[model samples]
Target: MLLVEDEDSLREILREFFENRGYEVIAVRSGEEALEVISNKKFQIGLFDLKLPGMDGIELARRARENDPDMLVLIMTGYPSEESVKKAAESGVYDYIVKPFRLEELEKIIEQVTKEWRMSRENRRLRKKLADLEGEIW
Candidate 1:
């Protein structure tokens, strides 16, 4: 996973937290850098700060989804407002949370999304195998 935030303190803390939890966290300070890293690498999820230096989190989410429609994005913001929430929801983000968010809550969201992704993939594989077997028998 990749984390995008400009705040040095928060960025460091979250990096340590997720890394300790067994994620190979690539933490970036700006949205532009985040996009560069993501475009080259394969990441299971993204945690983006809403008020990024080069690009806002909402726009980042939009572009990332365009590049990868199944990308699971969780947007974070210290600034809270109805308009921001509305815009984020419209962009097809997996989830968004206002900051001062709990690490536990973030972990939970990440875990659930990862689990769902795995389950869906496994189900698809099983269905494909079943179809192949039935065709061979017929």
Candidate 2:
């Protein structure tokens, strides 16, 4: 998991929370830092704060997807705006999470998304294996 949040306390809290839940989390303070990490590592899920010091969540999500289309992105915003929400959708963000939310709510969302992500990964692997087998038969 890749976590990008500007708030120090919230970042630490979320990092510890997910880590305790058996997730290997890479938490960063800014989108730039996240991008640096993203280039080297592939994360199945990314939780990004909507507002960042440089490169907002929407842009980061879009760019991250360009690097890894299978990466699922969730945007977290304390100040939610209609325009921003629409932009997030346009950027292919998987979900938008309003801040000051219950941890359980986030956990539920993560669980569901994780399940779907795993399924998709398995599907892709199967498809590739099928293609390889067909090639061998031919």
RMSD of each: 2.2, 1.1
Q: Candidate 2 lDDT, tens digit per residue, 59-137?
A: 9999999999999999999999999999999999999999889988999999998999999999999999999999999
Tens digits of per-residue lDDT for model 1, 1-138: 888889999999999998999988999998889888878886768888999897899899888878776678889998988998888989877788888889998889989988876787789899999999999999
lDDT of each: 0.87, 0.96
Model 2: residues with Cα > 4 Å off, grouped in runs: none
Using all chains and alpha carbons, the TM-scores for the candidates as numbered come to 0.86, 0.95
Per-residue lDDT value at 73 in model 2: 99
Provide the lowest-lDDT 10-residue window in model 1. Answer: 64-73
